[model samples]
Target: MKRILILFVLAGSMLSACNKFLETKPEDFVTPDNYYNTEADLDRALNGVYNRLVDNFGRMYSRGLFSFLSISDEFFYKNITITNLKVMDFDAGQLDVGKLWEVAYQGIDRANILLENVDKPKMDETRRKAIKGEALFLRAYFYFVLVDNFGGVPLKLKSTNNPLEKYLPRASVADVYASIVNDMKGADTLVSDISSYNYNERVTKTAVEAVLARVYLTMAGEPLKDVARYNDALIYADKVINSGKHNLNPDYSRIFINHSENKYDLQECIWEIGMYGNQLGNTQLAGAVGIENGVECTDDKIGYSTGPLKITARMFNLYAATDLRRDWAIAPYKYVTNTTTGVTTKTPYTAVQIYDRTVGKWRREYETVTPKNRNYNSTNFPVIRYSDVLLMKAEAETQVSGAPTAAAYDAVNKVRRRGYGKPINTPDATVDAPAGLDKADFLTYLQDERARELAFEGLRKHDLIRWGLYLSKMQSLAVDISTNAPSGFRYGANAAKNITARNLVFPIPNTEITVNHLVTQNPNW
Candidate 1:
């Protein structure tokens, strides 16, 4: 007999009596008629959806991440596929996109299935709506990622009983956005009004709002360029900030540390991926330091694993020498002494952190697994933070008017003030960015501030792309991505000039073009 997955329990449970007690009974593992008949079943089903986040690094990392990271300035290798890497040329026809396209749809499919079958008798009202909201938000979030990256993707709003419908044609971007906004709007009403969910694992109303703000801001930026959207973005962001549920943490360095995992700091973080690692004697390290210093015993090296995301020299120079974030950015070459050999070996590796210039922001304490290896560290990734909301509000305000407004400055200053390690200051020295900054200039300042405040958090590419500064940034990155002097391949100062705008949006992966007939290849693919 073939083994059936637990998700099929709902199908089995449906054939039995519609009694409330019958909903709690379990039949064979495959059919829903046996299971998924109760409140707990829905909860577990929602858990499965949350569980899918763990696999995102595998699927989304390939396509969405590559596209997001390809701000052209990020990673900068010729061989890296995605955005504008000089080290790697990606063919829009590449098949890797299929995995991303499939995984997101699968998640959406699961959401639809839950939505359709979850409304059984005896389900608790609050729990039911919460589950529905989460599923809806997740479906919306996944579609948002897909549509943003691929232009328009197949809109599979309902659960498909037929496998044949999987090949549906692409929907228009407008249609996709409409669905995303609607789903999120509904979700916002249903989700609980909490800022942090047991350390930010579960998404809340603010999470919906955060993404809504992002959606509006993105619309204001690209193919839409609707200046009117900025007002909507500002409103949503303002709502989240004024909710007064979050605040920045006192220590900026500790925010990403494992010991501080799930601790809600400044009202800044609206949503983040909550993670806990195995504490069973074995250790794990943060990706930044582990991948670079070769101190990690996990076989992940910063130089190798972090080649593309390294910090740029220009970024390093932007920080004030006294800033704590700067300390987190660059770790000094550390030497571990071997107790047995009485030998002190220096880990002499100095690889770029966020930019070649700045130090790595994410760090974890390394436990020595071997003479040269480290064992464990636990750190979580922040998906949406309050600081981003403020900045978005600032940008929106500037765009709505002509120059940075006092409100915009205050919002920007709040973030900068916290980073300054002082009482939150508005119009203070650190918060006192040039007052006369025009809309165009203020926009540049916002981009740089985002780089400073949110670097390595994965928002870099999105900001660069929206600003229309990706090509120029990528050229600077191209020179850096090329073989450095010590590595033999060299590009002079002028060599960076060779990079072009054609490289901005990544070629639709060659594999995707080969397989998906509906996708129109992006320009220069």
Candidate 2:
């Protein structure tokens, strides 16, 4: 399916995607001043903007935010040899610290460039508007990623080709968030509805709304305790929920399977980084999602995985025995490949072995692509899902009302029922959280529920930070791991032990600090 869309991105030039119909020829020698002269040129430029969101190859998402840089209470990127980024042990000068910053700003810069040149093309007015909306939304999305990870960053609005463009000081966190909210809101008005598309990758109005809900919810929580944004989050979430175009995929494992197989579950996965090829193709566009986070496998034929990132008992114990998502979401067996036969084998683990399981939510065994690379797979990484929107809606409504309302419970219970492998519309009191919990208890429910339903989707650390539980939770995890972990796995506790208040926000890259004299390094970095 991915092969059908041969997208090629070379710096700021050459790229394409199949509407399942046509392809654009790669272009060159056309400088920015004269490039945006045709409709195809606009399309190519837009794809380049999209190309910046690779979410793999140590760039962002799975490799950066989700795995190495972001510290999680659910799992730790276990490596005794290189503990830098994984354990929150690195500083401003770390190569990955710069890479993460570069990747995010690259996307932002590309989006800015596309927007500036968008109007230059002589194209269909409606198509032009849609492209403009997507550029605006992606730009905001990039900024949101920046603000979420690094707090206030140097907010550069205009595109610059000049290497000597004056380095600006960091923007206030509040101002950066304001800009994100405004841009996304504007994009919501101009973008096409998801219902209009046969494909899953394009920036849709609901995607904007969903991200807006996330931004608002984040604003309402720790660091920025703007409680008023809870109402805004609820409103945007309602817009997406009321759209009637999205829902939880009945099978949770199948949702990820769809990503692995290059199939789109638009009903559940609201937005994703639609990657293609196994990095062996001419385009070389691929992601290291399943390979980095999947169940450990020794044989390449069985889907090779160097799974340094691992889940633990904390995640395994979150689910009840009846919750079908538990075993499927966490690999419950040991993987072995007989060298002579070259056949992979699975042996069921005893109960205690759950503590050492690799991340199973993105098993590479399901990847349909042939001749798969051991390091990179063309698996699409989800950015937002309908289930996440539902959770945000439930959380927002509860925050605004100062208690868990019936609507809040219903939103979450729907997800819970699905997790229990029951009909979502049917209410099972045995499975549902009771309706009368206080705000504190309900938030506690949310914390656990989110992990159960959405673990390894690259959100846990941010969720912990927003809830103001990051420092205390990691510190607690350190103590727990130290006391309870199996002897072989106890070293995993070191990552949590390395946590400090400063780890809540990643350091601004040393490259930026040195190049931009006006900017200051983050605290204790």
Candidate 3:
């Protein structure tokens, strides 16, 4: 019997059964033979795969993965445990590393199980293909995360039924990426269009293409250095753009606000991890990034106190004053209440440094349906948005041509125009389009633009790593903070010296190496 814990809840009843026989007895357990026999069974099995995102202890998009990546230059956390990660002083024994590894494999195993038994369901052929596509895309996504973070990880394509079968070796980075590409390509054909899907929460055709573009862009960057893949990246990104299925959300703030209300825009969001409800299905995303109450911004009702990930002054300075994202992304000041005089006054960050510079996006006050509580927030985490596709197009186009092409300029300017609250095709040289730039300068601009647009979406560390600037950027940021930053800034002590080339890829969990003899740690713990 497979030991994989498969939870299938359908029609308010757990799928549990036992059998007894006098002669020639059969196994009295729920197996693939008994459980995966109908369309409803397959649907529930797929739901189990989606449930991994909501699993508080092991979800990839949860605080564990996000906090681990927060060690990058973009964020500062005061907690000693998290500060170590920010400074690149962590090792394989880190709990978040092990938990993310375990959970990613678990999700992969579930996806594999679903794909293996997909044919068992005698449902509509199109629906079965769609479910299989979702499972395949999910499996590829899990492997992509593992491969990107831990270098090459054990590629478990099939559900493990025996303990001995679990001892698999890590595949080469090239092989892992090939699998991801194949799965994504297959998914593009099998999955339904985004417009036809019920919600942006589920896998769709454009989601597959968007992720494929990202995968290709990563291939074109460090480690792999497959520069030729830039063409493919541009191809897929342009497909997402020309498909007319998605568009940039005109109002930048509304994008997050709508997500808080569980009202997603299929036109903008390609895919998001569905975080609904105030208790069971809620996430700590808002709380992790939100500002604490009783600060200069007390009027803002994001009453979350545990702001683990604080925005750094370095990140704050990246945004231009005219850019609407600057005010929306970072809080400029906080409110302090006077107990003696019974008065409240605003204190700008310039006057007094706020220890926790909270993230302005994903405010709890925007959540109309859920009860206001720090522990319970239903803000959906964005996985892929149309703006990301445009940015990817811009980056790939610049790399392929060795300069910014007209399409590249247009692609980037669309996102910039939205940020400045200008019309999409605004031709203003000063406000919208900054001209007279070479290839190198344009690439730099693209990198900064990505950070400004996609800050704190759990992509910063990986972005830096792929750009081959993770170690250098960390060291540089450490020096900047040590020399000029406020006294409250943490991680400056260890940041400059701790980060090394080996720190580019995180150490494989030591527990994984101990359990699987075939597993090897990334170079230098």
Q: What lDDT does the true structure give each of the candidates? A: 0.58, 0.81, 0.72
lDDT of 3 by residue, 268-293 (tens): 89988764444432122232223221
Off by over 4 Å in 2: 1-25, 81-83
RMSD of each: 7.0, 2.1, 6.4
> Where is model 1 more than 4 Å wrong at Cα?
1-29, 32-35, 61-71, 74-88, 93-96, 258-266, 276-309, 330-359, 366-378, 479-516
With a 3 Å backbone cut-off (N, CA, C), the pairs that clash in candidate 3 are 71-86, 295-334, 295-335, 296-334, 296-335, 297-335
RMSD value for candidate 2: 2.1
Residue 235 lDDT, candidate 1, scale 0-100: 86
Sorted on TM-score, highest at the top, how do the candidates line up?
A: 2, 3, 1
lDDT of 2 by residue, 1-525 (tens): 142253544354444443223444454556678777887777767776776676445567545656776668778765562446776677788888788788788778878888888888677898898889999998998898888888989899998788788889999899999999888988998999988886668889899999999999999997899999999999999999999989889988899888887788889989887766676755555777787787888777768896667786777888898998898778776578888897779867787786678777877888888797888877888889999999999999999999999999999999999998889988899899877899999989998999998888778989999999988988888888889888778877888888898988888898988889998878998
lDDT of 1: 0.58
Worst 10 residues of 1 by lDDT: 12-21
Query: Looking at candidate 1, what is the lDDT of residue 436?
Result: 84
Q: Tens digit of lDDT per residue, candidate 1, span 352-469?
A: 4322322345433332222222322223456788778888889888888778989998888887877778667535775456788878888888888887887655567677766666
